[model samples]
Target: MRRLLLFSGLVGALASCTTASESTTSTKPDRDPVAHSTIVECILYDGMTKTSPQLVTVTAGTEVQITDTVDYYFMKARVVKDGKTYSGYLQRQCFGK
Candidate 1:
């Protein structure tokens, strides 16, 4: 059930590619390097809160790139840690900045 729900959410996220792509492309090619952020604490990835299907426990101080903000608590972000890049929904409150 968890995997199914996560899969469905990912499909929904893909359907909104225009929005995600728009935000991703907003990054400046020149001066502005991709902003870096770290998970200030552990966060529960309920899957529904994020659009990604791959469910994994995000540990404290994990580095990531904010892809877009979905609301006050949820954000579309790319997890960049341990030599892996994962795109998903991360809680904004869990980040250090």
Candidate 2:
């Protein structure tokens, strides 16, 4: 009975360690060198191009984080609405300085 208890304890410890390691590894790291800005008024496209499907129509004063600049006209941006994060392309003119 003592050996069985010891074996069960060992298995429980191993399972806890595995769960901790998996949780750490599963976390997603944030993008590097990002700039926070506000949306003046724009639509977040699914792709860098305007022809891509429109994801959402962000209103003026909405907060956004600029991840990448596609060009003078378009930029890769991330938005948060209703506690959910949204990523897509936005026009440069729609961002405030």
Candidate 3:
């Protein structure tokens, strides 16, 4: 009777351990869409003497809609206008691209 109880306890502990490990391993990481929207409304500049660039003063909570994915050191973005829009490229790090 003692041996049987010990064996059952061991089996239950092992089963729970295996279930916990399986749950952890089965989890998938969150994925971002290939093309998505982002809002970056700031200016960054690389100075001749500065090792890293600096972000210039920008309006607080400025929201500009970015309509594409970043695929280069610089990414092109368009500014919305009533009649026409202007497009330009900004450094990837500046906008977390």
Report the C-alpha displacement of residue 5, candidate 3, in angstroms: 0.7
Quantify all predictions' global Cα lDDT against the true fold. 0.64, 0.82, 0.48
Candidates ranked, most accurate by lDDT first: 2, 1, 3
List ranges where model 3 is wrong by over 4 Å: 23-40, 43-97
Backbone clash pairs for candidate 1 read: none
lDDT digits (tens) for residues 1-96 of candidate 3: 999999999999999999898784546755432232334544532332224454342233433444343465654445433545444434454444
lDDT-superior candidate, 1 or 2: 2
Candidate 1 lDDT score relative to the true structure: 0.64
Question: Candidate 1: which stretches are off by over 4 Å?
Answer: 1-34, 44-54
CA lDDT, candidate 1, residue 81: 59
- What's the alpha carbon RMSD for model 1? 17.6
lDDT of 2 by residue, 1-97 (tens): 9999999999999999998987845567766647555546789899877799999988888778888777888888888887888888888888666
Residue 6 accuracy (lDDT) in model 1: 100
Note each model's CA RMSD in angstroms: 17.6, 8.4, 10.8
* The best candidate in terms of TM-score: 2
Residue-level lDDT tens digits of model 1 in 48-68: 355545545677766666656
Worst 10 residues of 2 by lDDT: 30-39
